[model samples]
Target chain A: MTVGTKHTHLTYPDIDEAVDDDVRQHMEGMMEAEKGVLQAREQEMEECECKEGMFPNPTPGRRAFLLGAAAVAASTLPRGASASSGKAPAGAIEFDVPDDPTKVQGRLTNDDGGYGTRSQFESEARWRFPTKTKETSWTMTPLAESEGIITPSGLHFERHHGGIPTIDPKKHSLIVHGMCDNPKKYSMDDIRKFPSVSRQYFIECSGNGLTEFKAPFLKTVQGTHGLTSTSEWTGVMLSTILNEVGVQDGAAWILAEGADAAVMTRSVPLDKAWDDAMLIYAQNGEAMRPEQGYPLRVFLPGWEGNTHIKWLRRLEISDKPFMTREETSKYTDVVKDGKARQFSFTMEAKSVITFPSGEMKLPKPGFYEITGLAWSGRGKVRQVEVTTDGGKTWLIASLEGPIQSLCHTRFRIPWMWDGNPALIASRCIDETGYVQPTIAEINDVRGLNGHPKFASIYHLNGIMAWTIGADGTVTNAAHKV
Target chain B: MLIHWSKTVILAGSLVAFIAAAPASAQKFNFGTTPSAEEIAKIDIDAMPDGRGLPPGSGTPAMGKNIYANSCAACHGVNLEGVSAAGGAALVGGRGSIGTPKTKKTVESYWPYASTLFDYVRRAMPFDKPGSLSNDEIYAVSAYILNKGKIIGDKDVMNAKTLPKVDMPNKDGFIPDPRPDVFNYR
Candidate 1:
């Protein structure tokens, strides 16, 4: 399979086995050549001495500047694709672009190391959080630059307890035991032999917008609401495998474990397994990214991202939740009454405005399309209402089509800004007949009384408000309760 | 309108018929191989509450002091307060401050089960070098940390029998999730 330079922002993981064998030997020498070629970015962008903010102020020849602002990008530099945050992805080759594309012939076809990378000009990528250890931290998707419902696989948000492990698929097998009559182990090859199903779903970190609960301290939309992403995952139904090994009577819970250095585990309900649980091996039509549990990962639709264990290895069926460190000490909600809430699985409905969001100054907005994403852990988003007057009045925004169940649905509304200080926001109504609540409403019920204040922050689907100033700058209009 | 209703009824009847024809079970996909008892034992390492899966071992807090200092103290402070190097919360103290604004959620304060303390330390402790410690070392460390928080006596032994029976301070602190916590108004 060949991925063309069609979508400039999508990274096509060329995982065809035939191509890997063909390019294995030749690619080794190319990788060695790339080593120790140090003086590149600083060397090429020497003209960018002005150093506006990491990159130079662009005079005119700019497209990367079109997204951010005034970055004098040295396109002359034969540079690798910058994901802006994590390690650079593979298969994208660096070559010189002609000053005028019409005057020169481009690089040879099928020479891009067999896979495709996003364009260098598209600098949108995930950003990491400052946790104690970098390995235990997470990265947020660049929601401000998002275009559609599906987040690019490379740009998908990630959370890891242990560092991402490199596991060979041929050796990895999932062991299923415990409260089951016939305990079984299925290799990756064996699991693939069963019939498979593909579905589009969104995996959201329960702590997605935790920072915004008390106040909007995080400046960017990426910081505020970027921990969720949608992907069309292809996998065999977990129930199909449960059928292979009969679950013993009274087996209600299953402990899913990962093979990472941390050996993470979370107990899942048997009902969820029968409902929509899957052992997904592929994402966005290709093998999963290493950061996303390459060989395999659990896909528990509509559940918190943490429960969907990555680099999955074992399954032990039982009648009780494991109450692991994550569930008890970390993810549990500490409420006002001194009692914590455990096993809070679903992420309620939430939405955020991407364009004209935090840190982006709307350049003299007369007519603009206010676009953003809204999704629910419960089910399909029935409606998304856009508000431009700080929760005064609302209008039903247009929902982008073929809205699937438990997935991110893009919403858009046309607005004519009159250059006044106005608050832009969106609220969602899921199919369950529940409307997204404000921060004040959430505080009233969940009680924003944690040690850190508003520490009962998980499953906070409060409406996000971004204020657009007369000077055309947009900032988070969080009502600090 | 009457014809449309009749058509819907017919469709519903066919759907019920289809449901009845196909059993509500998947035809057994026996592609999986029955794993050997030894293979299952090798990977089944998670320990649940009530002493469910604790390995056979014994240790006292006295034997755990050196292990804690050498292996865990770099991140978790010598005094049981976490260091910046580890970026983890304190292992002790914060016994009652969890739900308050001055909350400090340590193993002593927030954790609901003593089994969880042993389980977490064994599965992922020392941050960098995880699953490296022996079963006895895990038991010893668990006992030492518990004693530091005044949860157990200094001479209390931590074995499969004792660890599960040790009730944590916040043993009954947690409740099940009651969500859609707040509703939207028209």
Candidate 2:
């Protein structure tokens, strides 16, 4: 009762020592008076004085129940007021379990006071790509944690010609000039007013698989093949814009330009522009993320990603492409005999096993689900074959649904491990019935110019193999059988 | 809570006031200003293979020797041969290695256009410093290299007019792509 004093009847010692002698005596006296009153009430019940709905039989075990109830009540009394008063010792505090367990112990406040931070343990992947200049280099996405076909907008990979421009969409306009019957400029709003459509597709860099040409160059699948990504883009088709502008006859090519510091530009053929090209303004169901060209960009399905210009500003119709520096000096592939191959656009069929890939180690040999992504710019992936025994035998993998053309098709195969070392690889076959070739076969056809040039080795859609060692270390086994 | 409502209203009002007070011109975004022809003419020294963009300038090979000594000799050696100076790429010789494995194609050997030499140098050159040379200096250097390679005479004096007319050895070397045929895959 006094919070700290031990009574002769009570067995447990009270932890608090702040209560004085007077408070202890007062609590003990109150307990004694309550006991006396209870005894008198029992005597009266024995004399046949009963209340309504009370048997008043004066059972012998009833006193024990009353004593237990009184002990519980005594412990429930508030003695930790001093704790809230800030007078308790540094380490003597104890938390009480509330009568209602659903109640939260504390309130959280944020800058808006309505939002709260996620649990401290939760984390998301951060981008880590080197930069030579803001415009030229690229940053990779963490593909391992990506779910479904949509890459989370924040983690989308980036490749810019000039630095990212902070363009205010209100003032931005795209001019369709040159070989058009009536050259017209459309503001961002005007362009969006046209009939809009959405489709899921994958944009692959022409140099996506270049590093894997000679050998397994990068450790992670993201590093080796992250240049390819799938997104649901919403936009008005370039055909619709060209229809409004009324393209003139004999216009072979159109030059597209961006509003960045570099004023990046590229030449695209008119046929492709009128066919499947999209002047995209939205990605993954939202306004385009800044890294994916915030306001608007060109989305050419099944074409090289660079040709899908970002921060789009101008489109000039012409009979011949204005061969900008990007086309002539950079993207053009110098072949084996000093002849450079230009306009090599399509990214060929390729696939790589993402799970159990390089840098991953198996904890113990058991049943493992071998999963990966396969895609073809030519058409939909018809079939994916997994070679568990290094191409000696191949089995068709189960292709997941939503296999649209020019999109990444997910493939999975259940593989068993007997704890022995083995080589694993995947090969994709396109709808065109063209099988993805091996490194040797590709090089034999495209003649490796001893000097590495972008043109000679632009498309390296070769089979990627991963070797699991006896110790369970996985490595990019390019040549090791 | 009542005070908090008043504060929120005041903040929203200020934001609306600020946006309303902003100028209409400030709201419109312009990619870039259209530079005047005079201003652009100062920097548009791009020389096409036919010398389309070359400015009015002329230089003899004798004067080029001195200019080349001061400007081009550092990266390209004094004899017009390339230097192996760590970062500098080779600039001369290696002409007929186009189809061979030991090809070392350079300006003297591989370049198909004399005007390209003038164009490239005027736009981006002098490894450490780009766009620093005058049009006359670029023309003089172009003449010196062409005379050394025996493609042009010392008195040809390359300007906008003469630079385009200079005949290059491999001018007809390149052919348009005729592919997607049965032979392309084979």
Candidate 3:
């Protein structure tokens, strides 16, 4: 069998021999050139003065401006070695500076010792929500600064109930029991041996934009829509294991319990488990980060993030819901009329224009690209409409190609800024034909009581609007339609 | 019209018949190993609303205060007010505050079932050392918190049977999510 050969009848023997050999060869190649450096170089280039000494290739007034900005940024820098010690040779053998020109001077050869990091010149960082506790609070992904659909694994937004757990894969095992003919225990090796599949999907916390329920609260697009992240998840299907154990007839719910401190539990309907539920061990072509459940997690695409239990350890099938603390005491969406909504699993369609968003000022706007991300839990995003004049007029934004179901799709539209104040917004119509709602429309139906304010804040998928001033300043127009 | 309807029905019947036959021939790799009863017990810590997984242990509110003070009070507060810096949530308050803007949802005001408290505390409390509490200690602490919130009496014993039977104040607070509730109808 050659590379890329599709196995039609994959028995254990076929997988053990052919597939294992392929995987071993592939992994060996990856580990050798593991830095993921994409550039080629000459056999030997003369080490110029710039290579010997660390200095920002002088750009007229750029040095003076950056020095001032650097001084201001230093005060807020966390307790660590400075981002750039003056003498530190960083940014692919270039001088360590916020904005370096040596980057355009081209990169070094792909041969690094081992492992890799993002370039030092790229200074984008996730802003932490100003909460009293870091463990419970989340850090917002810099959405406005993002370039593509897939959030780099490092930049994926994090929301942990009991903090990220460090689990040894050697010691970790998933026990599948309750209402099965033969209850099973699968180690990570046993799981990897099963027929594997890779899929791209988005996991949005149902509490993605809880702050924007009553009024515009957070200042940046990241703060507004950072909780949702898309990734290429690779794993074995839950159905594969469920079938192996031989699910019993009367089973309705499956309780997925995590190995984290909280031992977080959520009851997933048997139908969803049979449908697209995946026990993922890898994300974006590599082992998942510890923050992202590491060795194993159940990925229930399009469902609330909490339902996709991380550090997954147990799955108990039963006729009734477990109604664990996570599903009952928390994660339930409280609506108006003083009642909460239970089992609101599927996250509806949502969209947001990332660029030209709050806290971002356009440097003299002329013709600008209005771009953002749109996704639906139910399926693919069908259309994204950009409205420069509030909701008066809307034009269908061009979706970047290869749109996948339950994954973030980048949408962009060209806009001529008239050098005057205007309301700009974007909304998505998903494959389900569900048009994303406005804040007012959603609040009206849910009934906004002053207590806890808006009735339900769990699934806030309303259209986000930004008002651009004549001076090129963009602010949230959350109240405007 | 009768002839045409019969022809269409015949076409659909065969399609249904083919679909029904497909699963019988479907493949199963039969992966993984059967776990023993001992192996199951080592990890099966889940507590259901029906008290199916509750261990054999009981404790009263009187026995709980000591454990709560030593291990939990530093973060959860002496009054269970919750220390923000420690990432603790206020556990007992916010009665009748659900519909108001100043809603301070607490264990007394919001939790619908008593089994949840026992389950949560047993698995995740004491912050520093989670899943370290004994079943009786978990029951005791749960009993203490519930009693302090005035939901349960001080003498009320929290065991598998009694814990599931304890009716919570906000038991009827939640409604099924009849969503597509927003104006975004598909």
Candidate 4:
């Protein structure tokens, strides 16, 4: 049952036989060897950090007058007798450096007894949208960097009012009161008693790309349009719950509220609730993660994300709407003509190119895969057109999946960058024949009054453009005339 | 031409019947499915843009100042200035900035209607404790904020009748949407 002596070849049985003298010695020796390797790696990393300025300029033709350049070169050189060995070039050294700082000590043994940490090399964090109130704000998913449709629960973006609260599910209960024959209270377990269903859908913030209305406001796709994400949600139909509670005559609206510090509330029309709304308890086939509302959240398909109240605690049915603060002071569209348009609930169709986008460089720029995401609240994206030289001409990009209605669809195009300056952008057309409008078109419809609050400019779904320079630098370009 | 003639004959016949029955239908003012006064009273808690939904309760500016200080001062600020340093929205004194570069819309200067303040607060306010304030408290706070902003006199009592009558400084600031025009598409 003795384990292997080598670090890479270490097996599990060694721990059980650790009492044996031979096995104990082998385990001790392996630990010492791993520690030595880790220490040496740390020293090498410190040296690299000290001489980071000494590295050869990756950006060709830049002035290389940095004082640490020599140190950077020396530290990067190969280590040990391998440098003198005939196998490699003279002065060449091979350093076994780990890809991430967390992995420097190597993989943990099975009995490590702790949660795993993400690699230090991963620089992703929750993308936040600047807001008027810190307690009530939103964060977005890193959709462009993600490989699949299922947003990782930890990486699931959040929109909260009054901040996130820690709720004990045992003590929490959802009360279906007002305008019902049988006002009922259901615990988390009571909700699970109904017939369960699972479906994948995308929830998009109405203000997903609000910042980019004027221009490209963020450098990364996560910052620009990360407010939308898709997840396989498991739950019972709200209609089924309503049926059990027995809706009374003349019921029109239901006031849904969260138990967060803000007690966020919204008035949802009953017709939509009976159609496709779900009281979700699980996300991505697992128990709901804390950020995705741990215990439960309401899911209203094809509607704005705010109405899908997370950490749901109550539902009060009434003949009229509550006109909550979120729905009034916020969310309502203020037009240019001194009029505020209320009840604007749907998020329009939109698309954006993620790869070769801002803050990226085209490495030699030949044939590259131009990839991005397209989605529509009205229905499936009928087509996505890419314009290589801005809006003058466009070609239809290939859609990659069985286009689902009201879902995020990945689109790709085989683009050849000819080492010349070019402007790239994508436009989406939904099943409803509603073309994604330009910034001017949206402004014309919404109108701008110059006042930041009443500017009617929050939900901007215009086409986004990125410019690639001849020198391989990519920048967010303004919409060309 | 034959089909057109036939359709006209049928329309004429129907119009004659409708004219004949119009008087009978108009004899009674049918407010369709008029709920009992008691039933209506139970659910008519909405605050309208015209102050149509204000409840029977009333609040004065003096009482409202104390209530706001206790419940809302933490986030909204004492002068209703909003916590600008902490990034909270300014709730008062941004009156003439609309259509200008430095517009700071607040209750005193920017809101188009006073009814909105009552509606928004009755349903959601105090940030931490929504739907917890009484109708009188909501009315008083609305009066205090409006009076402080100089929109109304200190003695003014905000009730269903007075709220809609109070004129907002930026009442005419909003403009209609002009889209799908040559300016938008091109």
Candidate 3 clash pair list: A450-B101, A451-B100, A451-B101, A452-B100, A452-B101
Candidate 3: stretches off by over 4 Å? A1-111, A450-455, B1-26
Q: lDDT tens digits, residues B1-186, model 1?
A: 999999999999997897677675745657778999999988778788978989999889998999999999988888988775456567998788877766668899998898888888888887878988899999999999999999999999999999988979999999989887886734
Candidate 2 on B51-132: residue-level lDDT in tens?
5556888886877888888877886778777554322345566566553444444566556667667766664565446567
- Candidate 3 chain A lDDT trough over 10 residues, lowest sum: A36-45
Cα lDDT for residue B82, candidate 1 = 74
Q: Is the docking of candidate 4 incorrect, acceptable, medium or high quality?
A: incorrect
Q: 1 or 3, which is superior by TM-score?
A: 1
Candidate 1, pairs of clashing residues = A56-A72
- Which has the higher lDDT value, candidate number 3 or candidate number 4? 3
Chain B TM (all candidates): 0.85, 0.72, 0.84, 0.73
lDDT of 4 by residue, A1-481 (tens): 1101111121222234213332234334433432443243334334332322211111211111122233334554332111122121112222233223253453335422454444222323464554546576677676545654566767778887767778898877777767876666677888887768998788888777654554444544666678888888899888887776668899999988777766667789999888889999999877887767768889888788889888887787888766556665566566554455555667777888877665455655588888888888778899999988877889999997788888888888998989899889998888877788777777666566534422454566778788877765556663442
Ranked by DockQ from best down, the candidates are 1, 3, 4, 2
**CA lDDT, every model vs. true structure:** 0.77, 0.64, 0.75, 0.66
Residues forming the 10-long window of minimal summed lDDT in candidate 4 chain A: A1-10
The best-first sequence of candidates by lDDT reads 1, 3, 4, 2
DockQ in order: 0.41, 0.04, 0.35, 0.08
What TM-score number comes out for model 2? 0.65
Residue B33's lDDT within candidate 1 is 89
Candidate 3 structure quality by residue, lDDT tens digits, B1-186: 999999999999997797677673255555667889999998888787788899999999999999999999988889988775565677898888775655556789888888888878878877788888999999999999999999889799999989988888889988888888775655
How do the residues A1-481 of candidate 2 rate in per-residue lDDT, one tens digit apiece? 0001001121212323333333334334323432343344345334332222111123322332344334434565343111122121122232222233244333223332453333211222323333323345565555544455666666577787555779899988777776765566777888888769999898877766555555554555666677778888999888877776667888999878776655566779999998899999998887997778768899889887889888888777777755454554445554545665567677778787876676455655788888888898878999999987878899999999878899988899999977788899998988877677777676655565523321244666778888877655566776442
Docking quality tier of model 3:
acceptable
lDDT tens digits, residue span A1-481, model 3? 0001111111111112222222333223322221111010010111111111111111112332355345535554332223334421222222323233333333334534466655433434555554545555566676876777999888888878777888999889999999998798889988899879999999998878776776775555776788988899999999888888888999999999889877878999999999999999999999998989989999999999989999999999999988788777678876667788889899999999987786555656578888999999889999999999878999999999899999999999999988888899999999988999998888877766522433466888888999877766667678685
Fnat of each candidate: 0.84, 0.05, 0.77, 0.14
